[model samples]
Target: MEFHLVSLILAFKKDTVGIPLAEISYFWGQMGAGKTSIARLINYCLGGSIELSPALQNEFVSAKLTVRLKKGPLEIERGRDSNTVVVKWGEKEDAIQASIPARDANGELIPGTGIENLSDLLFWMSALVPPRVRKSKTKADSETKRLSMRNLLWYCYLDQDEIDSSFFYLDSRDPFSRLASLDVVRYVTGYHDEHILDLEAQLDSLRGERMAMLASIESLARVLRDVGVESEPEIHARVSRLRETADAIFREISQQRNASVSERTTVHALDGLTAQAQALNVRISGLDDAISEVLHARDRDTRHLHEIETLSIKFRRSQSARAVLAGVQFHSCPRCAQILPERPKDNCIVCGQAEIDDIPDSTEEALLQRDIKQRSEELKEIIRRHDAAIIQLRREREELDIKKRRVERERNEASARFDSAYLSSMLNKERERSALQQQADSLAAMARFPQILDSQRQKVGAIQAQEAKLRGKLKDAREAAEKDATNINTLGQLFLDCLVRSEVPGITSSDTVEIPTNSYLPEIHSPGIADNTVVSFATLSSGGKKTLFKCCFAVAMHRLATKVGAPLPGMLIIDSPMKNISERENREQFEGFYNMIYELKANELSATQFILIDKEYTAPVEELDLSLFSRHMKPNDPSKPLDPETAPLIPYYLGN
Candidate 1:
């Protein structure tokens, strides 16, 4: 997979800036000259989060990135205030809206939003398949790890802050960043694929099953021990003893059954006694039920009568209070302490009007009294009905009780005459025999205990065998991974070669140089250096050395990918690589960096695109062909403000 940046358009409110990209383009200027902003805008258009400067925010409305993928060209546009990206395929006006840190089903931001997400879309355009990597080395599962284009971008972009650091790839202090860095390296180096990931997932599942089987076997053994059947021999012995005891009981029951048939003449008498006893039991149950019903009714009627009596008392008190108030005459207003005019004795005092004696009306007190009288009569009727019902139910219950007692006496006499004592003894013996038979059957079921144990052992054996087979497969996978180490080593050697060509101090070909297989980081160990020396991108002291090392390493990886036909996006944008270098001290090393890049253009890396952003032109830049120099903006060039006026405008596509 290969992707080349064709151009970038930064559209401002009043103006726009268009930057045409080449194989080796440089945005060289002084500090705060907006050199880094160009690189940031490119990244922003590619679905990166951006914190725009006040100037850029006020000037730029949106940024657009145009790239030529293997399939065709694509244009991605993004506004300054939003993370949404609008992508347009070649010659297609229909824009696709997408964003980064996509929301999941629960509407929470998670990596790899969906098919329309910028990361996945870019991957699709690049023809690169996303690979799986362990989220953590300690927990390796299919569902736990993921490698998206967003994570891969960490390697492709180097901001000014990180260009001189020894740990160039350490974008943040997050644990996931470190893991993702390793995974991205593994993926781009052609060391991981779907088949490897599938094998890992299967191994994880198999291990889980094996553990469960072991736990089950342990639990079964414990249960067997609690039942006094710890071993096969003990189980067999118990079974034999139970069988003998059951057989002896059965023989006794058979003899008793045979002897009981001789007493068939008494069965008729026994049946008559049983019928009499059953009739008495039924009569007693019905009498008890009737008594209960009558008692419940009496209780309910008593509560209702009490309520009626209370209501009657309350009404009588209310009438008494009203009569007393009606007799009193007011001489003055109590509230205002004012004298009142005299009135007739039968007049209504509240309304200051004469009472009409002929008016036919019942007062509120009279209505309440009538209601109380009605409720009292109703209560009295309920009491009378309850008392009568109780009396009748008691009479009926007494008669049934008398009949039941007489029938019971007769039933007992008949049972004695029929010799029920002998029949009862036989029935008890039969029940005991049935219980013993059941116990024997239960013991006999344990005869297969040895087979069960054997089955468990076979299961464990099978799991172990499967584990061994998977181990062999894993070993083969490791071997294949080792074989792929050559590609990384080749890149590492190229890195060392570039450093030597750039004349970096204390760096030589004899130095042990290689990209650590685990970290996928370039490590160099010079002679006489301490055994514990930290030799990594972060530990490089000289700024020029660090920048040169990072550039060389990136170029080496690009070359290796092309050589091995690996899926790389085929574009690298380095920002401000001249931060720590002075022309007087490191002119040769600075020139060597660009010279190496220029040399690779004539070789297999010719198709690769490199965007270099720095503060000034080095020796190599002066010697390089003028056509290779893309865009150079001065600090305050009136003719070429960071936001140019003649650049093409970003269309209002997808409402962005």
Candidate 2:
């Protein structure tokens, strides 16, 4: 993906300074002239924390950087000592701006980007899927975390201080950073491809499912043991015996009812009691339906009221946003990256047309507020009425229940008056039948436990089968990727070539650098020195040699990315590359380093953009398409003090 900076704007308390960048820009100046400070400001705007000098801390107001991505131009603005960056994207008239927290994102999605933070937004704008690596390397089934933009920046941005002190953070004291650095190497080298990542995600999910199923099986077994049902067959036999006894009791009760019919002399009285009970039952059912209707109406009204309340809240928030953002104007078309023209008085700042008031009138706002209030009040009143109706219906139903019981008692009394002995026998038989039927029902319910257990076992077997198939597929995908060893070898060869051109001491074209897929660190083998003795970045003692060594590798990485269409941003920023190396003593090495960098920009990396900050300027013989911006800044030295106008960055303060 292409990423190039258009300009860096520093808003100081005294005045604002705009530094325009080109395809190749150079910021060279005297000591303490804020040459390195320019790079630090850019990094800070992009979500890096740097120790600001006292001069800047007191005078600086804010920093803004406009960057052109593949999609369009995005402007990022960060205030002094602020943790959030305000990003403006999209077109001029239809622009969108959101505040994104740099740190402590806590997995929040930025509005309109569908991404969690600035890092994810950058990857999304570049049309690249953020790569994922295992959080814990020791566990194969560990969850994965995304390799963020900050991780990739380790390769792109080389600070003035860290250039000689750090080697791509590979030797970082923090274990997480060290591991992430290794993963970044693996990613750009093509070892962590998309297909392999997808397979890993699938396998992780399957492992979770398998573990859950195993837990469920253990829990079900424990429950069965507690109930004394040792086996499914034993429970089935017990249920069968209970059913047989219940059937015999049912038959005996049926014979007793048949014999009692002849002794029932109060048949007419019994019929009257049945009719009255039927009337009461119908009245109770009517009351139940009335209560249900009232409840349904109340529930529907309550939902409507909730929706209106939510709408009212959103409306108020919208008004607040308008008031806060009033009179904000855009100076550039974010989509096309063009300067905006001045509009007529009272014209729309966005479209440069006549202003059309979109804010609601006071009368309309009042009407809306009144409508919401009235609707809420009406709903409350309806709900109160429904509650009263429900209570009334329940009271009526209770009265009918009393009448129903009285009819039953009267029928029983009339039967006893006719034949007390027969009634007593029938009542005893009915009670016995009820007890037997209840036992049968309970046994039938328990019989379902064995069936449920069998179903659960089947589910577990199915999941295991699926898991086995997925694991096989994942293994095959990984094996296929590991067999293709071309990417890592190519990267290693590029690193060696860059080292030769940069002219690091004790390194030549004959040396070989090996970056194995397992550990993505360069192991140099120089035949002129010691072929058997492996020389790596850690073995390099000279600070100058280390700075050039790290820079050379970074250039080679960008070159490789350009050739293979890797997802590295098309920009590089190097600050104080010659901090430890003096140009007068190391002329050959210094010139060779700049020569190599310019040649790459002119040829293989022609599309790449570079920002170099140093004490001196080096130009190539050949003229490039886009003129390189070389700004020389002078500090306000007290002895032969320079004017504030000479200082291009921060001019007012004296402290470094």
RMSD, every candidate, angstroms: 25.7, 25.5
**Model 1, residue pairs in steric clash:** 166-537, 166-538, 167-538
Q: lDDT values of the candidates?
A: 0.68, 0.78
Model 2 agreement with the true structure over 42-103: per-residue lDDT tens digits: 88888888788767878888999998987788888989889988888899889978888765
Task: Name model 1 segments beyond 4 Å from true.
Answer: 90-116, 140-144, 170-173, 197-475, 528-535, 618-627, 637-656
Q: Which candidate is the best by TM-score?
A: 2
Name the lDDT value of residue 108 in candidate 1: 25
Residue pairs in clash, model 2: none
Which ten contiguous residues of candidate 1 have the minimum total lDDT? 647-656
lDDT of 2: 0.78
Error of 1 at 289 (Å): 32
Go through the candidates in order and give the clash count of each. Answer: 3, 0
Highest lDDT scorer? 2
Q: What TM-score goes with each of the models?
A: 0.55, 0.64
- Candidate 1 yields a Cα-based lDDT of 0.68
lDDT of 1 by residue, 520-586 (tens): 7778898888977856777877677777777777777777778877776777788866567775677
